[model samples]
Target: MRVPILRQGPYLIASIQAAVTDEDLLHLGQEVVERVGQYRSRGVILDVTVLDVMDSFAARTLRDLARAVRLRGAETVIVGIQPEVAFSMVRLGLSLEGVGTALDLEDGLALLDQHVRRRGKGGR
Candidate 1:
């Protein structure tokens, strides 16, 4: 299934609504990167609120996606990682290094705003 991505001013918000396969993640990464360039987006907010399981592959995919977005001169913030999911990732050593994370969508947006400001980039 396709992940819905919404462009909010200088930010792109992608909310993962359910458990997704590796292929879905790959597609998501590619689509997010393309959209970042296409929209000249300054930031990306990935909301995985409904995601209950976070395996190593999923963690790695998300880390790579954030890196790719960074290369496009955009910042990526992953939000809504449930407490259980976070615990599992930590236990499994699945880290999303070099990527910012927040408690929720609102927090993610705020974090992105801070990043954009720090980089001297304009925001919405």
Candidate 2:
């Protein structure tokens, strides 16, 4: 089941709690986009802790979700990618460049909080 980890002020945190199939990945992307719209949030922290594998579809979906968040005047940060998965992404030349990433959930929230503070300082 998809679980939202936190909701603080204008920031929301969500978890992708399973090995996502291609179809599920697409649905997840859509759901994130929709949630961003529904919440009118400023940022999102996506906890991918339960995801052990990252395929092309998952990567693409995440990229799409980031784009969608931006279009909704929000930002997306991905977290909890295992070291091995990070290595694989680097080896595959996957570009999560514009998308923020954190080693763990706490770091992800801290990053998001920082971004929010920065944006509040007229960085938007």
List candidate 2 stretches off by more than 4 Å.
1-8
lDDT of each: 0.93, 0.79
Mind giving the per-residue lDDT tens digits that candidate 1 earns over 33-68? 999999999999999999999888889999999999
Q: Clashing residue pairs, candidate 1?
A: none
Q: Highest TM-score, which number?
A: 1
- Model 2: residue 44 alpha-carbon error in angstroms: 0.9
The window of 10 residues in a row where model 2 has the poorest summed lDDT is 1-10
The clash count of every prediction, one per candidate, is: 0, 0
**Model 2, residue 26: C-alpha shift (Å):** 1.3
Error of 2 at 63 (Å): 0.9
Measured against the true structure, the TM-scores of the candidates, in listed sequence, are: 0.95, 0.86
